[model samples]
Target: MNILITGSTGMVGKNLINHNNAKEYSISGPSSKEINLLDKSKILDWLAKNPTDLIIHCAGLVGGIQANINNQSGFLFNNLQMGINLIDAAYKSGIRNFINLGSSCIYPKNISNEIDESMLLSGKLEETNEGYAIAKISVAKYCQFLSEKGFNYKTIIPCNIYGKYDDFSETGSHMIPGVIARMHKAKINNDNYIEIWGDGKARREFMYAEDLADAIWFCVKNIKQIPKFINVGIGEDFSIKDYYQTISEIVGFKGEFKFNRTKPVGMKRKLICSKIINQLGWMPKFSLNKGISYTYNYYTKEIQN
Candidate 1:
């Protein structure tokens, strides 16, 4: 099974490649020179030329809350184009077995504990990431529509994935990497306190990237009885304040946290339930502490250089 992955350098894509099973899988991680996603001609041409059996789309302009707020147009346009182009090309070229990865941000902001797959598009999305959320919704629905039309494709909505290969840059990284970077920088600079956004009251679900990869492989291998769209998460959540405290402790950031009430937190609470995926015998195995520590080490060792 030769799998085509677009965003090989991203956090999730990096974990998907670095896993031991990935070495066994016939996977191709083409650099930008191979196929620019926005270049429709290039993407279609590449699909027609390359004989790929599967396409695990991991590309797009992804960022955290602040990044989303700053670059709404880029997020919406890039993600929409990437999703539309990849799926259209793959479908037209007669390639099936597609796996589209979407964010939990697609869920409505007010969704309470254990968000089901059906709750999508039911309410207003978090304003901070509304553009990104809308783009993700389109992608997910695109896959779902194709699935309904008898395409052998699936979409996995993972919640707040973080691990090795994550962007440690403060401005563009997600919560986990961003927090780790902040903690590391604070520790190095001997800063007194760390600033958190939106009062640190919101809750979120997180899954290790490696665990997400495991779940992806599990779904790919067992596509039988799979839903058109499924939620991939740890089935648990933690408040942002608690998450910051944990990361601070792991990175040895001995400082107080200052919450800025003026900033806008994306979702009040978002955690996806894996009842559908779990019933098929797939599960994620990483505690918040362990994943944060592993990711912190990776960022400090590989990225901080």
Candidate 2:
């Protein structure tokens, strides 16, 4: 099968392209300067280059809460344009098997702590990333509409992804990567304290990016009637305060972290109630501590090597 992935340079995409265990498939992404999702015409032209059988829509404008707040227009516009353009082009080109990547933030704020797929669009989203959330929701709707029209597309929403090849760059990284960078710097400098956002009361669910890649390939290979949409997560819950302690331990930063109440602490916690995928006999294998350790080791060696 010929496969294409978008957002190939980002954390999730980088991990997926490298971790995909599927052997007999051809894979391509944006880094080759082949497909720029921002330009609709470019999307069409790129799609024509290959009679691809499948597309992993992993491309989008994504970042931490700060980036979302500081660049709402760019976040919302670019991501919306990319999703609509690519999905429509895939449909027009007769590529039925498309995967629309989504985020857990699309779920409503009042969603039960352990959120479910059915809870989407049931309430308002967290305001900090509402624009980004709406774009993801649109993709979900687009996939469902296409499926109803007899197209075979699927949208899989993942929560708090982390692991190898994360963007440690100052502007692009998310919470996990951000924390890793901060804690690592602190460790190197022998600092005594790290600063975190809000009251450190918020909870989040995290999955290693490689484990998510595994789940994606599993879905592609095993499921025929891809439930239109599904949730991907570790089915575990953790708080930011606990996370800081964990990262501190992993990086050996014996410092205390101050909770900055002024900053936004997205949702209290977002644990995807992925009973559907779990019932299909899939579960995340990496614990947060171990995943953090490996990620730290990666950046450490990246600096050393």
lDDT of 2 by residue, 1-305 (tens): 88888878877788877874756688877663677777778888888877789898888888888889898888888888889988998998899798888999899995656888888888988999989998889988998999888877889988788888787877888888888898989888999899999998888898888889988987878646458888999888888898888988888898888989988888877888888988887888888888988998998898436
Q: Rate the local accuracy (lDDT) of all candidates.
A: 0.86, 0.84
Residue 210 error for model 1, in Å? 0.5
Q: How high is the lDDT of residue 221 in model 2?
A: 80
TM-score versus the correct structure, for each prediction: 0.97, 0.96
Query: What's the C-alpha lDDT at position 206 in model 2?
Result: 87
TM-score for candidate 1, residues paired by index: 0.97
Count: clashes, candidate 2 = 4
Range of the 10 consecutive residues with the lowest summed lDDT in candidate 2: 29-38
lDDT of 1 at 102: 88
